[model samples]
Target: MIEAHALIKRYGDRRAVDELSFIVKPGQVTGFLGPNGAGKSTTMRMIVGLDRPTAGTVTVAGRPYREHTAPLCQVGALLEATAVHRGRTARNHLLALAQTHGISSRRVDEVLGLVGLADVARRRAGGFSLGMGQRLGIAAALLGDPAVVILDEPVNGLDPDGVRWLRDLLKGLATEGRTVLVSSHLMSEMAVTAEHLVIIGRGRLLADTTVSDLIDRVGVGSVLVRSPNGADLRDLLVRHGAEVTGVEPGLFQAAGLDAATIGDLALAGGLAVHELTPRRASLEDAYLELTREAVEYR
Candidate 1:
């Protein structure tokens, strides 16, 4: 598990992360979400001890990342996929990382196959494609079978097939009871991959909640009603405190009311209800609502 309590990071007069606290528990994938300059990368760096916190503390499996007996074995991270030695082969890079913690050559080969880079294991990393480079970074992260995994935009350069594979792999890791914290700007993928979310903006915590809860908090959603007696239904709905907007002659969008209520009103008004569809708020909608004001740099 990963616990961050009142974490803060600063560079000169600017604060990148400010008193952020969130727990990334085991057995689930927690998505770390924010805008481009929301300090997500800075926070991730602090978690792995790559950058020092200006205040507060963060721990992986109960201790600071640097304090662990074998840091790599405890927490595996992919901060930058392309930050590798240009001279080394993919296999050699993983082998070198394993050597730091006395990890075996067998584990190196295992992770290479696990990430679908076995075919290019002997090729120089600099010559690999973007997707291939990402695979190698993930391979290094899994070399020790670490208890905690932190990946920043793991699917940035992946193709559709590679993206699907990564989704399955992350879910599998969480199922194995490892703490998985993934940072991504892809809302569609996060909606399907993450059970929980940690959303921040302008270096402040905006939300730390489940996907369903976040959607609910944003608002149940507006209801779409298509009726033959649209005129009467609109007046009836407006009188009932619903904010209704006409999409066309026969279709209207009703907010501050549910489908059941709208349908009942239409039926009571002798209106022919053609359709009463409740469009639930999506993750994208909720995210935009929460972060609209908090966004920095426009």
Candidate 2:
């Protein structure tokens, strides 16, 4: 599990992360979402002890990452796929990381195969493609078999199949009772992969919620009611405090009311209802509405 309390990070005149607090639980995948330069990468760096928090505390498994005896065994992070030695082979990269923590060479080969980098394991990382580089970075992360996994844009350069593989891989890690925190700009992928979300903007915590709860809280959904008695239905619905608008001659859009309530009101007024379809808001819609003001770059 990852716990951060009022975490703050400053760089001279700029406060990149400001008083951000959120808990990432184990046994589930948590998405870390934000706009460009929303301090997501900064926060993730602090979680792994690569950067220090200017104020507040963030701990991995009840202790700061640097304080752990074997940090690699406690947390596996893939912050930058390209932050490797250019001349080193993919296999050497993992081997180098494993050597730091005294991990067996067999484990090194295992992770290489696990990430599907075994075929080109001997190739220099400098010549690898973007997708291949990402795979190598992931292999290094899993080398220690940490209890917590933190990945920043793991699917940055992956193809569709690679993206699907990453989704399943993260889910499998969480199912094993490990804390999985992932950051991505792809909202659609996140909607399917993450059970919970921690969204931030302008270095502040905007939302920490489950996917279902976030959708419900946004509540911008509208119910489309089609009827022969469209005029009468609209009148009755407006009387009940519903905002109604005629999309066309026979179709009406009702806001601030659910489908069941609208249908009930139509029935009581003796209106012939044809269709009562609810147009629910998507995650992208909710995210934009929630973080509209917090967006720094527009």
Candidate 3:
């Protein structure tokens, strides 16, 4: 688990992170979301002790990252996949990190295979493609089998297949009761992979809720109803206090009423209903609505 209390970070006069606090628990994937310049990178850096917090504290598995005897075994992070040395092979890069913590060569090979980098293990990292480089970074992250995993844009250079593989890998890690906190702008993927979310805007905590709860809070969902008697249905729905809009000659959308309620109302009005489907807001929709005021980069 990872915990942050009133965390603050400042660069000269500007505050990058301001009084942020959130708890990321084990056994589930938590998504860290925000618009550009929302202090997400700064916050992630602070979590792993890449940057010191001006105030407050952040701990991984009950203590600050520096206090752990085997820091890599407690938390593994991929803040910058391109930070590796260009002269080293993918296997050499991981082997170097493994040696720092006394991790075995056998385990290094295991992670290489786990990340599908065994084929390119002997290849120099500088010559690797963007996707291959990302795979190597992930290999280093899982090298210690840490209890907590932190990744920032892990799918940045991945193809569709790699994206799918990463989604499965993150879910699998969380299933093992590891505390997984991933930052990504891909709302659709997060909606499927993450059970909970910690949203920040301008370095402040905006929301810490589940994916379903966040969508329900926006409450922008509507029910689409199709019928031959569209006009009549629209009038009836409006009279029943539902905000109705015509989509076409035979279809309408209704808000402030659920599908079941609309179906019952249409049935009571003796109207023939061809279709009634609920259209809840997507994760992207909710994210935009919530961070509308918090966006700094427009």
Candidate 4:
């Protein structure tokens, strides 16, 4: 498990991460979300002890990463970019990492194979394409076989197939009861991949909730009605204490009434109804609602 209590990071005059606090439990993938320049990198840097927090503390498995023996074996991370030396082969880089924790060479080959980089294990990393570099970086992160996995923008620059592969891999890792904390700006991907969300803006916490909860909070309830007599139906629904809105010129959105009840009302009122569809709130809409004012740039 990873827990942060009032974490703060400052640079010169700016507060990069402002008293951000959240707990990421094992057995699930928690998505870390924020806009550009929202202190995401800084926060991750602090978590791994690469940057000391200005205030507060963050612990992985009940200890700060820097305080742990075999830090790599306890926590694995991929920051902004894969920092592999251009001259070395993929196999050599992973071997180097594994060796740091006194891990065996066999583990090196195992991770390389697991990340599907075994075919190019001997190829120069400098010659690798962006996607290949990402795969190699992921291979290195897994070298320690750490209990906590932290990835910053893991799918950036990946092809469609590569993106899907990473999604599956992250999910599978969580199934093994590992703590997976991922920072990403990809809302659509997060909507599908993340079970919980930790949202930040301007280095401050904005939300920490399940994806479904956020959706429900913003979605509330809305009814989609297709009928020629929309005007009449709107008046009736409004009179009955239903909140109404216009989705389009003709179609009306209704709240406080179920489809079945709406249909019965329409029939009793002798209205020509063509369709009635309900739209539950979506994660994208909920995220926007929560972070709309938190965005730094237009």
The prediction achieving the highest TM-score against the true structure is 1
> Candidate 4 has what TM-score?
0.86
Highest lDDT model number: 3
Cα lDDT listed for each candidate = 0.92, 0.92, 0.93, 0.88
lDDT of 3 by residue, 28-49 (tens): 9999999999999999999988
Candidate 2 whole-model C-alpha lDDT, 0 to 1: 0.92
Deviation of model 2 at 155, angstroms: 1.3
Relative to the unseen true structure, what is the C-alpha lDDT of residue 78 in candidate 1, on a scale of 0 to 100? 99
For every model shown, the clashing-pair count is 0, 0, 0, 0
Candidate 3 segments exceeding 4 Å error = 227-249, 252-274
Pairs with backbone N, CA or C atoms under 3 Å apart (clashes), candidate 3: none
Q: 24-86, model 1: which lDDT tens digit per residue? A: 999999999999899999999999999999999999888999999998889999999999999
Candidate 4 error regions (>4 Å): 220-223, 229-272
Q: Per-candidate TM vs. native?
A: 0.89, 0.85, 0.87, 0.86
